[model samples]
Target: MSESANDTAQPVTDWEGYSFDTRQVHAGEYPDRNTGLRVPPIAMSAGYVFDDFDDQVDRFAGRSIDPIYSRQGNPTNAVAEERLASLEGGTGSVAVSSGQAAISSALFALAQHGDHIVSTASIYGGTRILFGRSFKRFGIEFDYVWDADDDAEWERAIRPTTKAIFTETIPNPRNDVTDLRRIAEIAARYNLPVVVDNTVGTPALIRPFEHGADIVVHSTTKFLTGHGAAVGGAVVDGGRFDWAAAERAGRAYPLITAAPRPGLGSMLDRFGTGAYARAVREAVVNDIGPSLSPFNGFLLHQGMETLSLRMERHVDSSLSIAAWLEQQPEVESVDYAGLPSNALHGLALRDYDGRTGSVFGVAVRGGIDGARAFVNGLRVFSRMTGIGDTRSMVIHPLSSTHATFPQEINDRLGITPGLLRLSIGLEAVDDLKRDLRAGLDRVAALATPAVSLAG
Candidate 1:
């Protein structure tokens, strides 16, 4: 007998039409029939046993979607993948080893050698590096549009070989929110699918699909995992992109829309709305072998249970702290869109309800000296190179994440000597404020004159 057939209480598999809070807790959770385990247990097996010879053949022949190897899929990871897909309103999702892997797999399925991709210039520093170095080495070209609003710039960048348009929902170190609707419109004109990295802006704050994105990627290591414990990533298929339409328009995605063998059908034909995600799993992730560990997969599902509750605290604290930082005398500027004075505040109000996100940039009065002093003075905020953590963290972007970039690129990105990226955590608001004040005090002291040695 099947696990569900024998169990008295069946798991809630379909999370559609449920509230975000309800789905996050209950969606994708399967009851353990053998032991009646309340929570989904870690599926540690590398392979599953088949009942007979035909069962194994059917799986290999694409007649069934059963897992043949842990490298492609895992039950523990499936819970997290399904929960995330439901949360993001996608048809399906694929979990991977890291955010970079998710991005690489998502794009590799769409564009291969000789193909090109257009991206919004403002994105994660690591992503930019990946595109410039590894993707370039693979013969996959990338063109960047500095201004998303400028149709001319976008037109100039997008070419006949362009397979997709890439961007971020809430780009960090500078919380400048992208206008997904506008980009989607541009993409529709060219029949290109829009791939968005909703890493900084988790589904709690913004569902990119709702705003017209065709695909969504996440660095589950950050906000989705909630804690700093596990490092994982996921790619969600919005299920709305018309694959046939894009192919007709001359941008072919063979991995998703083409068949693998003489007798087999295409992923699009077999899976319909879920084709892209299946292609990412079978074609890219399986071949490259960036499978997420079941151990981290367990942590991912558990972390998502309290996503909304954690995000509320994260955004609430960020709004308060951004406002406070803007008023500090030693602070040069704040890059949080939640601040009314910010250039992107209008966009933030329109889409994000003024709660942009926790990670943002703050420039102190002094140059690198002020940044060094401020970083050294912070007792509460950690001096680190990560964002979206439960603990408040600070890092000088110009000297760290953006260090390898050319001076011109850093200048364009506004990564100045004194600019520091702050990832606010679930810590007390007052304590976080005090920590900022201490950092500012250090910056203020940089300008203070000392007594003459002669005296």
Candidate 2:
């Protein structure tokens, strides 16, 4: 026998103790047994084979977690899920078709038709639309707390039927960072789990779980994918919430705590720390059928590999651009928390080290006309509705994202006519500044009065 026969070596599989940078690239990847493929290949099969009759029975009966169908789970999606979970410091995650699917699945797992959710006033406008339109039609109500710091406002918003507290780590457009710790404290008092949207503030910058969120959701289409080539989403379970205690306190999450069938145990008892994610996967995502494609799943995992690196460049460019815009005569104000002059700079410094993500707002001198001129003037920045992409993007939220909402609601949320949301990208900082100056020049032209030559 060869000397090597006496020793056996196994690949490093457990990534729990690895640093974020290392884990991002290696956490969910596994050696392909058949061909020793280093990269995780997209397993596109819709159905999985069972070992025997008993294996199929076990799978359908919930005895085995092996995927029976791709609608429920897939190997490719699993890689993205595990990688996202590892990065977000969660017990488990479920990849879905889109960010809206992730949010709906995540909340649907906890609340039923009659339940309510309290969210901070300043959130993604699309999310607000989802709540007002789809969620409202489903009989699930939402209340917005404008002043998160005011306990009275939270008290007024959160009712007895409230099942979850929803908030974003960094609210879109304005870049107003939520006080997650305060929200967590309020959630703890009511025995409600806090669900945070970390799409804007990716795990590379701020893991909401560390700040006390119980569930984290992401729009993988944005920063996590980096290239903006794929649209996907994921819901990660923080695994620290006390479900039993919450039930005792009169907040019951039936799907997680109740058995699907008489013979089967509750997801909480079966999956333990990963129960919430399991509930989201099996109960909501499986039932709703917003499954992520294997191709997108492959892209999501690959995109995460460079998440931290991209976020660093994104934040650096944003900081430089935001500071520059503040001094521009045509600019009205910059809504970046990283700026010392901003109201949320203290919170940004404490939680995010003053490196808030690249997406923020810049208001020009004139109102709607100024926004129109500024947007039409930009050459480098793509005028689009998406954020967190590798290419810089700009959108007039008042005209696009928040157009359907009432004027008072827009005013309350600070979606001003002159304000333009900017997503700084990986381009050279000087180039981005020059592009922005071009936009500001248009805004300045708007303020200039036309000469009356006839006079």
Candidate maximizing lDDT: 2
lDDT (Cα, tens digit) per residue for candidate 2, span 1-455 = 65585486877779999999999999988889999898989998999989999999999999899999999999999999999999999999999999999999999998988999999999999999999999999999999999988999988888889999999999999999999999999999999999999999999999999999999999999999989999999999999999999999998999999888998999999999999999999889989999999999999999999999999999999999999999999998999999999999999999999998999999998899999999999999999989998899999999899999999999999989999999999999999999999988988887789988995
Per residue, candidate 1 scores C-alpha lDDT tens digits across 307-348 of 999999999999999898888899999999999999988899
lDDT of 2 at 329: 96
lDDT of 1: 0.93
After superposing candidate 2 on the true structure, give the runs of residues whose Cα lies further than 4 Å from its correct spot: 1-8, 452-455
Task: Return the lDDT, model 2, position 339.
Answer: 100
Counting clashing residue pairs in each candidate, in order, gives 0, 0
- The regions of model 1 sitting more than 4 angstroms off are 1-10, 453-455
Instruction: For model 2, give the 10-residue run with minimal summed lDDT.
Output: 1-10
